[model samples]
Structures are given as structure tokens and as C-alpha cells.
Target: MIRVEEAIAIVEANSTKMPVKQISVSKALGYVLAEKVISPINMPPFRQSAMDGYAFKHSIRHQYDIVGVSQAGDHSNIKLKTTEAIRIFTGAFVPDNADTVVMQEHVMANKESILIAAMPEKNTNVRPKGEQIAKGEVVFEANTLITPAAIGFLASLGIMTIAVYKKPKSAILVTGNELVKPGQKLKKGKIFESNSVMLQAGLQTFGLEKTKVYRVKDNLKATKKALESILNKFDIVLISGGISVGDYDFVKEALLQNDVKELFYKINQKPGKPMFFGSKNETLVFALPGNPASSLTNFYIYVAPAIKNKMGFAEIHKPKLVRKLNADIQNTTGKTLFLKAKYDETNVTVLDGQSSAMLNTFAVANSLLIVPQEIEEYKKDELVTLLPID
Candidate 1:
């Protein structure tokens, strides 16, 4: 067993980056860029009108000749002489020699001639070339996750494909013979198999939807067989249950027998003390506790970070904030406790149902109050560190 920080350090030290692949920029959302993306050319390419108006050199003119019109995508290579105005619309290229634009709302048109009731200042309503981004500017740094806005920006830069860290494919193994699929009638000691579904849904949030499920009976040979088969296929494997020192707990032994190096077997934490982490070459494995709440909590704390690391994310953990506790608290156990907490934007109150089996309170709780292992008691209104359930 080790401290929570030490466990995280071990995972971070061993987690390796996945291979990079080039794909369409539109399909790279939620993926980290493997290389810096630079603008290939100046945005707008030429001076453009930023408003529906007339483009002209500001010369204190109240009326000018409406020589020609310029609209978006028009290749009219028009130029304006002094005191000349051209009808223009938003996003249209401004003619050469035009340094300002007066909105149509402030002008009155009479036939082919127009009158400027008010003139904008010089260079007003004109989007200068390269104003948004220079040709050589680095718009996205390596390791930056591509977002929707990033897709648009990359498209504007004429980038069709981008190099991004490949998403890690994972396998989920839920072990136990006392489990049955949902919608099936319970037979004696059988309970609904939720860990596999829960894990798959959890992994999907990270855009890791390419997950396969395999259930095994609580037998050494069955567990070993599942481990050997999955370790050869997936970059990551998540096994729920059968890690504790129980009569039917065969996952730990099965993992060890298949040459999966045991990095850490346990942590100094509650709800998930039997959390197991191991690896073989580039494959990372997490043996989460069986209980639903414990499995989800451990998944957030450990498995999420591992996936982020593999995806080349720079930050693994969510930001922690300190909030005042609404009630007094005490902990005598020699292990850290991640108490389900309800943060009502003002103060944080620890929820009642904190047992590993209960997800009722866990669902309502928006944060986890971090109570140190050595701390005995805390008075009401005291500040406590917590991580939001985002």
C-alpha cells in the first residue's frame, strides 16, 4: 500500500504515449495534437469589409459616386480613386485604395449615387490581412486537445488533416459468477452485471468508446484466460472485482501469472482500497473494486488519468477547490477518505450514504471532500479540499 500521491506518481511514470496518426481535422475532435499547427497563410488574405456598407477612402465626403459593388467571393479586381465609394457587403474584399467603410444604415442611396450621412474613422469596419492570425503563427501547440472552435479555426487556415495522438482502445472484464445480465431474472445469489456497462459508459466520456466487455467466472483458470487474451489485444484493460483477498478473488493472481507486472496493489484510500494497477510493456491495466460506487470513484481517480496520459493530455487531474464544510467531521481510520459531498455553491455538506455500494448519494453529490488519513476531526464551517465531479 502507498499514499494516493505516490500511486499517481507511479502511474504517471509508467504511462507511455500512444502512437500518432494523421486524420481529417473534422474527425480529430477531443484528440490531442501530436504536432504544433501553424497557419499556412494570412487569414482573410486581403483587406475585407467587416460590415454591410460602402468602401471608400475617408476624405470627409458626404456624397460620392457608387462606382461598383463587391460581394463575398467576387473576383472583381476593382480599385477606388480619391473620393470614390464602392458598394460592399460583410466579408467582401475591400477594393485597393479604400481605407474605410461607412455602414449602409448610415447612408441614403438615390439611384446609382449614394450619400454618407456619417462617415466612419479611417480603417474602420475593415478586417486587415492577417489580423486574426499571421501565416507562420502557431495556432495550436502540441498536446492541445482539438475542440469545435479549433476545427473551424483549422479549416479557416486551410488545414484538412491533422496529426493527433491515437486514442487508446480498452477492454473491460467483469468477473464473478454471482452476476447476471440486466433484464434477466435473479436466481438465488445472482445480481445484475452492472460493472461492465458502468465501465463502458465511463470510458465513453473520454471519447474512448472502443471498449469490449468480457465476463469471467470466479475461477483461477477462467480469470487467467481472460487476462491473457485481453492483454495481447488492448492498450488498456479494466478488470472490475476479484482483487481483494477473498476466497474467489483470482484476478490478482491471474494478472501476475500472465507476466503483468504488479505496480501497486492498494492505496491508502477509502471506498477503493483494493484498487490494483499493473502493466505489461505498453498495456496498462486497472483492477477496480467490485462495488459500483467504488469502481466509479477509482475510475475517476486512476483510470481517467492513465487514459489522459496515453492521449498526451498535459493535465490529468481536475482542479481542486477549498470550501467550508457545512457540518463537523471526524475520521479515525488510517486511510484517506473520499467522502461524497454536496456543494450547493455556498458550502459543502457531506452526504449520508457514503458506503462503497451506494450510488444514490454519489449521483447527487457534485464533489468529493478529501479528508486526510491522519486527521481525526473537523469542526463545522471549516475549509476542506475537494475535487468537483466534472
Candidate 2:
């Protein structure tokens, strides 16, 4: 058994970031960059007009001769003289001598000349070269998550591919004899199996959808065989159920026999006291308690961080904030308790039915109130620590 903090530290120390791969910028969405990106050229490459109007050197004069038309993609070297302007459209490169642009609506045009409604500020309606990003500049640092705006920015600089951490592949092994698949008839002493589906949804939250779910009966030979078959096939293996000290519990023995080194067997927390963490080479193995709520909670606190760290998340820990308790709490000794709770901006209220097997309260919980192991009681309106749930 170990404290929650120690358990977290152990998981983090063993979870290393996954190897990097080169992928197209278009396909790199939601992936963390494994290397910095340097801009190969200036974002705009040249000074450009920002509006449909005339480009000319700034002047206080009211009229100017319209020398030529400059649309986008025009790269001609037509120079502008004083009292002369070019009919330019938006995104058109500014002529060599042009320093400003007056919008078409702001000027009245004649056949060969236009009257400026007023003397405008210098450099108005013009996007200067390298204004957004300079050539050879480091645009994004390593570990930065690629977003849609980032993709657009990189595309503007002509970036075709990027280096990013690969998402972890996962496998789930469910062990039990008294379980039945959902949508099937409920036989005696059997309940619907749900941990695999629930965990699949959780893994998808981190963009890890290439997960395989396998089932094993409670027999030791079957459990060992199942663990051995996929022990090296995934970056993470979640074994739900058969971890407690029951006659049918063979997960620990099977993991050890299959070269999975046990890092820890338990955590000093309510509902998840029987959790297990182990490793074989680079693959992480977690033997979660069979109770649905406990399995999910342990996964969120322990297993999720491992996956996230391997995926290059900057912060792999969940945040805990202090909020005033909306009601009193009767605490128990010898274990750190996690009670499903609802919290507003200023207050947190513990929900009812906090047993390890009941997930109803967790369904409506926005946070988990943390009750330290040594604490015995808490009064109303007391300050409490809470971890927000995603």
C-alpha cells in the first residue's frame, strides 16, 4: 500500500514520452509537436494591400493619377511617383514606392484620377513584410499542441510536415466469470460487463482509439494466457477485475508470471484500495478494481496520467482547488477518501451513495472532494480540497 502522492510519482517516473514521427501538418491536428518549427520564409513574403483601393506614397494632396492596376499575385516592378497611385485589390503586393493604401469607399474615382477624401495616417491598410512571422524565426516550441489556428499559421509559412509524439495504442483485458455482455439475457449471478466500453470512451478522450478489448475467464490458466498474448502488443494494458484477494483473483500472479513487474499493489484511497500498477519493458499494466466507479476513478487518477505523459501533454496532473463545503462531512480513518461531489463557483457539496460500486453519484459529480486519511470530521462551510472532473 502507498499514499496517493507516492502512487502518482511512481506512475510519472515510469511513463516516458512516446517516440516521434513525421506527419503532414494537415494530419497533425490534436498532436503535440516533438520538435520546434522554424519559419522558412516571411509569413506574407512582401508588403501587401489590406483593402480594395489605390496604393500610393502618403501625401496631403486630394487627387492622384491612377498609373496601373495591381491585383493579388501581381509581382511587377511598377514604381509609384508623387501624386500617382495604383488601383490595388486586397492581398495585392504593394508597389515598390507605395507606402499606404486608402480604401475604395474613402476615395472618389475618375477615369484616370482619384480624389482622396482626406489625408490618412501613414502606412494605413498595408500589411508589412514579415509583420506576422519573420523568416527563419522559431514559430512553435517543442511540446506545443497543434491547433487549427496553428495549422493555418504553419500553412501560411508553407510548412508541409511536422514532428509529433505518437499517440499510445492500448489494450483492455476484462476478467470475470459472473459477467455477461450488455443486450444479452441476464442469467443468475451474472451482471452486464461495462468496464471495457467505459474505458474505451476514456481512452478516446486522449485521441487513443486504436484499443483492443479482450476477455478472460477467472481461471488462472486462462488469465495467464490472456496476459501473455497481448502483454507486448500495446503501450498500455488495462486489466479490470480479479485483483482483490479472492479465490478467483489471478491477475497479480498472471502479471508476475508474464514478466510484468509489480510497481505497487494498492493505494491508500477509498474505493480503489485494491488498484495495481506494473510494467513490462515499455508497456504499462494496470489492474483496476472490478467495481465500475473504482475502476474508472483509478484510471483517471493513475492510468490516465501515464497515457497523457506518453502522448506529450505539458501538464499530466489534474488540478485540485479549495472550496468551502456546503454541508458537514462524517469522515472515516485509515484511508484517503474520494467522495463524488458537485461544486459551484464558491461551494462544494458531497453527493449521496458514495460506495465503491455505485456510480450514480459520480455521473452527476463535477468534482471529487478529497478527504485526507488522518482527518475524522469536517464542519459545514469548511474549506475543502476538490479535484474537478472532465
Candidate 3:
């Protein structure tokens, strides 16, 4: 068995960056930028009012006379001279001659002229052109994820399209002859297939949507044929079962027979020691344990980050937080254990069960408490690393 870090390093070395493509801003969310996005025009495009007030010069301290009324999207044709003010609403362009703005509430207005109660400050209430974004400036850098706020920022720069990396295609294959389809009546010793559904939903969190699920009986011929058939279609293939040393486990043998390059066969981790990884024709193949929690945990820790990096994201790992353990934890040596835990601002508590097959306790889990291989027991109030669920 190999260490977890060694296995991760092997996977990262074989990972390839995806090519870039131009996509419309409407459909660019969650994709990583391939090129630097620069602003073509100044944000606001011209000097505008930041608030609903009156536009005038600072020299006109006490006197105020209405010259014109300017609303949003209106061009100011009338210029303000000494002691002259224009009624301006929010987002209206400020005239060239105007240098200050006095709020309407501070000024007492009559039929034609107004009374200034206070002196207006220079450049007050004015959103100057290029104040938010300057023309020809790099608004976003390459490999940055396009979020909702990022889209708005690009729109403000008049960018309708952007270059982003294409989403990678992934597939899930479940192996077991005793497994029956959902909605079907359960027979004696027959279990419903739930791994594929759980994995599909979990994979979606990492922006993977176009995933296909295939079921194969417990046999070498069937597993080999299924693996070879789906190998050419997807960039990554996830196998849920048939990787252990049982009599029916044939996924590893089938992959070897197909000339797939083996990265690592097993890792020194609990409930997932049989996890395997390989590649063929630049397509990745992951042999995960049959247990639901084990498969999901492995996917989040290793596969998800690999997919994100392949899609050109600059940061592939999720955010980690350091928290004090509320209880003492024990773990087997020589393998890093990622146990489900409940964490909040005050403290973090480990879940009741650490079994790979269990999924009930993981539902309410907000973080994963990591225990390194070198440590045996963590006393109460021990600071530990926690990986937040994204």
C-alpha cells in the first residue's frame, strides 16, 4: 500500500490542463478564465452622480439657481455657472463645468431658484469616469473561476464574451450482480443500487454534470468489456466496486489486461485501502471502494481537486480551517483518516460512526476532521485541520 500523499502526487503528475475556448458570458459561470480579461471602456463611461442630489460648482457657496434637471441616462447639455445648480438624480452624468454636488435636502427649492443651506464639497457625490475600472486594465486574470460577481464585473467593462476552459466529461460505473435497480421490489439478499446516485449528486458539486452510470455484473469478461467500451468516451471513469481481493473482484485485472497504466493500486487509508488509480489513452480511471461514504470521501479529497485542476482552475483544493477537537480521537497508524465531524464557530465534534459503509451520520456533517498517520490519539482541545464542504 502507498501513502496518501504519494498517491496524490502521482495523480497530479498525470493530470493535464484542458484547452481554452470562447464562450458567451451568459454561460460562463463556474468556468475558469483562460485569458486575461481587460476592460474595453471605463466603468460608468462618464462622470455621474453617486446619489440623488443637485450638481453645482464649489465656488457657489450660498446661492443656488435651478439651471436644468438631469435624471439617470440623461446627458447634461446645460452647464452650471457661478451660483447656478442643476437638479440631478442618481446615476446622471455630471456636466463638464460642474465640480461639486449639494444634496437636494440641504437646499430649499422654490419656483425657479433654490436656497443653499450649506456649502457643497468639491467632487462630492460624483462617481468619476474610470473610478471603478480603468480602460485597458486587466479586470480578471487567467485561471480565475467565473462567479456571479465576476460576470457582473465583466459586464460593467462591456465584455460580452470570454475565454474559458471546457468542462471535462466523467462517467461512473457500478459493479455487483446482487444490486437491483431502484423502484424494483427487493428480493432475498438483494440490495438497491445507491452508490451511483450518491456519487452523481456529489460529483455535481464540483461542476461535473454530464455523467453516465453503468452497471456490470461481478465477472472479469463483463467488467473488461464495460471498462474498454466507456474508456474512449469520457475523460475520467469512476468505478465504485470490484477492486478488492475478493473472488469476484476483477476491475484491477481487467484494467491491466487492457494495458492501462497503473498509477497506484492501494493507499494506506482506512475503509478505502483498496482504492486504485490508473490511466489509458490520457483518460483517468479511479477504482473506488464499494462503501458509499468511502467513495464519496475519496472523490472529494482526490478526484474533485484533480477535475478542477484539469479544468484550469488556479486553486484546486478547498478551504481548510483549524479547529479544536471537542473529544479525544483515536486512529490506526500509517494512514491519514478523514472522519466526518460537526463543526461550528465554537467547537468541532467527531461523528459517531467512522465506518465507510455508513452514510447517515455524514448527512449532518459540515466538516471533515483529518487525522494524520503519525498520530495515535488526539486529546481534548487539540487543534486539528478541518476541510469544509464546498
Residue-level lDDT tens digits of model 1 in 54-153: 9888886788888899999986767787767899999998887888998999999975778888777899999999999989999899999899999999
Whole-model lDDT per candidate = 0.90, 0.90, 0.86
Candidate 3 differs from the real structure by a C-alpha RMSD in angstroms, to one decimal, of: 1.6
Clash pairs, model 3 backbone: none
Clashing pairs in 1: none
Rank candidates by TM-score, best first.
1, 3, 2
* Clash totals for all candidate models: 0, 0, 0
Instruction: Supply the global lDDT for candidate 3.
Output: 0.86
After superposing candidate 2 on the true structure, give the runs of residues whose Cα lies further than 4 Å from its correct spot: none
> In model 3, which regions exceed 4 Å deviation?
118-120
For residues 37-138, write the lDDT of model 3, one tens digit per residue. 889999879999887878887873677788799998888568677878888998898988887778878888886787778766789899998998889888
Clashes by residue pair, model 2: none
The TM-score leader among the candidates is: 1
